[model samples]
Target: MIRIGAVSYLNTKPLICGLRERLSGIGKLSLNLPSRLAQDLAAGRLDVALIPSVEYFRATGYSIVSNAVIGCRGPVWSVRLLSRVPIQQIKRLALDEGSRTSAAMVRVLLSEMHGLSPETIPLAIDQTPETVDADAILVIGDRAMHPEHGVYEEIWDLGDRWCRWTELPFVFAMWVARPGVDTTGLAEILQASRDEGLRSLETIASREAATHGLTNEDLHRYFVENLHFHLGPGERAGLQAFQEKATALGLVDTPKSTL
Candidate 1:
């Protein structure tokens, strides 16, 4: 049976909607934090995963299923950079450990877009907002939704920043499988899953929000309107551009395979 690892985030619910009912007979699926999924995929503990794009560079053999993604063309409110000072004067930045792609994007932006070399520290899971002396802290997923009250003077949306810098969309994550996995079957399954999710978005959003104590309207807006699930040509171009800048900054090793 195939072992699939998925992110346990609101942004990912649509991608996995109805998957439990549809794929139950086919394989075992596990939900995990994004960072844990990356670690498990690296250790060969999972056969497939919806992982952050940057983790693809760390894996030696992996392939992405085409036409599926966790991405956005404009503002993605979930992944943001919260700062206590202006970005230009910030000296240290705390990066969320859950997202390698967003962290890398932040580094690329700091060096290429802002022309600054700020010290970036990885935030620990239990670390409080006051633990770091950094001027800004980068947060992803739920943490980003609610930072410490009054700690941040400005919240820079990463997707908005990318749009301003490149005038292109941003892709945060993609469905990836280990090398030699049945690519055709995996692709078919993922595409079907995405379609199923889109079809029942309302139901998924309502149930998820009720369970989490979030406003259903807010969750619906985030899933259907704010996030774009497909990785089309524009997003692909943006991904390529991001990789180029990351490679130039020596943040990622040269990617041996195409996205």
Candidate 2:
């Protein structure tokens, strides 16, 4: 059986909805944080993974499986930077320890869009923005959706920033596999799973909402409106722009898309 890695975030639920009953006979599912999934896939423990786009640049032999992605065209509720200081006046940022792509995207946005490169420190999982020794802090995943995070006077949603800057959706992650692996029919499998998941979103949202401390309605809206799955023409243009910016900023080595 092919071992595939998927992240356990609320944003990913739609892609994996009804996946077990459907792909169970084909691929083995392994759920973990996005960063860990990236590492395991890179280390050869996984046959394929839904991995951060930046990780594709760091590792070799990763051929992207097209037609699906974790991305946003507008304001993504998660992956935010919170601060009382303005983006220009900020001197330091506490980066999320769990983020690989969002953290890099923050740097890219700051350097390319704002002309600011503040000192950065890793923000611990349990640490609050006020407790961290930085003017601003990047928080991603479910924790970023917390009610308490509203205390921040300035909130910078990275996806919205990217769209406004580049006028294209920002692709956070995509399905990729080792080049030598036999991935025939794999993209079709991934796309089919995504289609099934999208069709059964309400049930998936209801089942997963409470687990993430969000209401069913909230999760449903997040799935249908905030998060985007298709890596079509717009998303591909965005990904290309993002890669160019990341490479130009020296955040990662240049990566060529397989599809």
Candidate 3:
């Protein structure tokens, strides 16, 4: 059976909705953090995964497997950088432990936009942003959807910043398979799952809102307005742009080829 892993973030609901049942006879579905899923896929523990975009750049033999994606055209409320000081004045940053892509994105944004190379620390997944003492902190996934208690000098929705700066949509994650894997009909299954998920957003929001401490309306709006689920020409361009920037910044090695 194919061992497929998916990200466990709320944002991924639309992509994986009804996926388990659909894959019942053909594969096994599992949920994991983006970083862990990347590790598992690279180590041959998983045949396929929906992993962070940066991880895709770092892999040598992975192929993008589906058009369904986790992306943003403008402000993505879930990937945010909260600063305690001015952007240029940031000297130290703390990154969420669960993020591999956002960490690289934050570094690229800082270097490109402000020309500052700040020291970075890790903010454990269980730790709140307030627990970290740094000039700025990067937060991702469900935690980022909620506002922190205190004030900051600047709050950047990384997707919005990236789009405004590059004029392309930002793709956060996508389905990928290890080299030599048989993907003949996998793409269509994933795409169909995405379509079904889109139609069930209200049910998904209602079921998940309480778990994430968000109102159903707010969660539903977030899914509809702040996120994009398709990988098209614009998203592809943005992905390539991000890959180049991350490569130049030395966050990831040169990619073997485009997916």
TM-score of each: 0.93, 0.93, 0.97
lDDT of 1 by residue, 1-259 (tens): 7888899888888888767776676777899888889888878898889998878766687888657789988888888888899888889899988788999988888787779878889887677656877899888887677667787787888888988888998888888888777655767777788988998888887888866657888888888767999988898888888878788888877665465
Global lDDT of each model? 0.82, 0.84, 0.92
TM-score of 1: 0.93
- Model 2: weakest 10-residue lDDT segment is 145-154
Over 4 Å off in model 2, which ranges?
Answer: 147-150, 257-259
lDDT for model 2: 0.84
Writing each residue's lDDT as its tens digit, candidate 2 over 50-115 gives 999888877777888757789999989988988768788879889987779999899998898779
Listed per candidate, the RMSD to the true structure in angstroms reads: 1.7, 1.7, 1.0
The lDDT leader among the candidates is 3
